[model samples]
Target: MAVSHLPRTSGRLAIIAGAGALPHHVAEAARRQGEDPFIIALSREADADWSGFDHATLAIGDFAAISKAFAAEGIDRVVLSGAVRRRPDWRDIRPTLKTLAKVPSVLRTLVSGGDDAVLRMAMDLIEASGARVIGAHEVVPGLLADIGPIGEHTSTDDDLRDIEAGIAAANALGTLDVGQGAVAIGGRVVALEGAEGTDAMLARVAELKADGRVSSRRRGVLVKLCKPQQDERADLPSIGPSTVAGAEAAGLAGIAVEAGRALVLERPAVIETANRSGLFVLGIERNARERPR
Candidate 1:
């Protein structure tokens, strides 16, 4: 699929890529739009496909090195994307002499902190160096999921119940800073995504289906939304073609995301795959009235 063109940014763009294709998508959008983004692909998580871009491969522990790379490239703006599963251990971090000044505080945060807090600290570290940190959506707005059903299939009444249940369950889980996805089958919460992420949660659901733990009669629904307390810029929930396949494998009736907040990558492919697999993909608004106390 062709990358969508977006309005060009004034300063040079630096992509801090982690795992998955989200980085590739951002780079494609930047390149196609003539922004010419320089990517700082993390060695621990970023993929090899990024070889096509003007990029430098670095380790997650080397915060100082990342800043230097960006500075060298004259990058004044940055976008963070993909999954960094875990922060680098203190032992693994190698701060340059120039970066050593901030190491004590940064390491302290990494050693004992919330994921969101750590990411915010990381952003602050970067921004302190004069580079602007931006969300991936800013670089490619088309990646944000639109509201309502995305494919030919609409939600059945039963599916709606599951979606609501899943939303409530996911939000409850999110409050703990646990995760952003939950699976509800037949109006009951079958599974809540944990540290492992959405795909892992779906894999567990598939096991439940095979073991008769979850009813496969009406199929379930996968609901992924932003955590109310989440730093929206760092960890917004995202769904793509792989998500469709995972939900289908778990015998889900459909997949739902919080419109505007969640990202829908490979949009056409996601809708087509969902339709082909007999699953519906919808973006919903978590009713303000229904929010968990």
Candidate 2:
């Protein structure tokens, strides 16, 4: 079968900027591909410069409003990227009648957290509005990390054991919608993240170690994974140089993430910092199950 490539300059592109550095990266890549991206900034969740796109709009959780804005700009190609802060409480939604009507159905499909279903629904909505939702990575292929340890040094025996143990524990916690991250030392869990967030979880583990609740052979390990059935387009767990700083502060020997499933923002700097601190930063697949002792 002969494949036909769509001309890169063929259509209008819209960037639904959320938060963090990903959206900006996507926008830059879109410009490189010869499309002037129309940026829509999520209220308080996206960068201020996002408003400088060819056309821009600000909205909270109102999907209908977002759809209307896209329609107004005549955008037929769209890409969504960046960090969206999950809101369990719906008080601030201010939903339009159209969005309100879909809320019950979305909630029924979504269950608790994880935005995969919601993004799928949003993609459906975008398609219905006569636009195609493109994969965010297609615009920025280099952002994907190479599969491996991703640093200068290999993990020590103790570091490897802790990494495996942390991955297993994190996977278990993810099954419950608790979180995708955990801290461990000597093959034992010291802290499990929840709604409080990763930094807070690290602090809690540090406190527990100070109080002699969890002991470390030398230090601990931080492991983050993608929840089973997680939406890769959104809500994927991410780490970077700051994570290494957090691990150092909490006396962690290493950090492990699910290979190809986790996002490593600021890759060069993150790896450099990890190497400088003698921290092991490795990636493993989801089924790289920790062996039984």
Candidate 3:
């Protein structure tokens, strides 16, 4: 749903903030819509300054505290935002009665399953506590990427080939619930993002190029796409100014993400960075058949 047309509710909105600027962005958007959102900043995981809003800092594993805060603040709607750097220690979790029964299964998933599975379980727990979970995009739809080039530069035919290779690799990786990003160069898959994430994957590519393992003559493309079984409300693939800098340092020709499914953080800054670095940022439509769960 579009941000402007979001249905109004009497109940307050609570932002379960983690690391990065995304949570701040969502909070600002909510305020613009005339809602005073209560920020539930996860201790250590959240990095933004939340002093401007009505907020409480709490441990990520303290579910009992979070549930109590939600009730006290009258927060019936919740939006999960930002990157979580670490999984909570099983010993630290203090589940409420509603979540106590499923604690064992949730802990098992946290230890063994991939990110998608862990997130799904987290969302289920949040709902079980009586608060409705919503995606960050629902609060800030303008952040979604549009189709075609987002900067002055555009992809070349050779770059398109690399992009195609990246898409295939990224999608396959997503099917395993491993990650959502891949790098392709000279029309061949070069690196698939693992738990280390997109930036680290690009850094690896740069290192390989420096060692002359991968050819530096031909640049590549970085493609990020949603997992076939991804829940759109959280952890959508995203790129920003730092991504442009990483691609430039990695000697990449461009970056591509699924048009409607990816988030383009700090669009203006990303565009300016890409243009100055002579890199292209394109949003391509994903092929349904190519995404096998």
Which window of ten consecutive residues has the lowest lDDT sum in model 3? Answer: 284-293
Report the number of the highest-lDDT candidate. Answer: 3
Tell me which of candidates 2 and 3 scores higher on TM-score. Answer: 3
Ranking by TM-score: 3, 1, 2
- How would you encode candidate 1's per-residue C-alpha lDDT over 89-117 as one tens digit per residue? 77877666555565447777778866776
Question: Which candidate order results from sorting by lDDT in descending order?
Answer: 3, 1, 2
TM-score quality measure for candidate 1: 0.91
Model 2: per-residue lDDT, tens digit, 29-64?
667767788888777678647544665656655666
Off by over 4 Å in 1: 1-10, 95-105, 288-293
Q: Weakest 10 consecutive residues, lDDT, candidate 2?
A: 1-10
Lowest lDDT 10-residue stretch of candidate 1: 1-10
State the lDDT of candidate 3 residue by residue for 1-293, as single tens digits. 23444688889999999988889988998898888999999998999999899999999888889989988999888999989878776787777878867555887876787888778877887887888998777777578887788989988878878888888888898999988999999998889898787889999999999999999998999999999899988999999899999999999998998887899998899999999999999988776323211
Top candidate, metric TM-score: 3
lDDT assessment of candidate 2: 0.71
Error of 2 at 43 (Å): 1.0
In model 1, pairs of residues that clash are: none
Quote each prediction's TM-score.
0.91, 0.81, 0.93
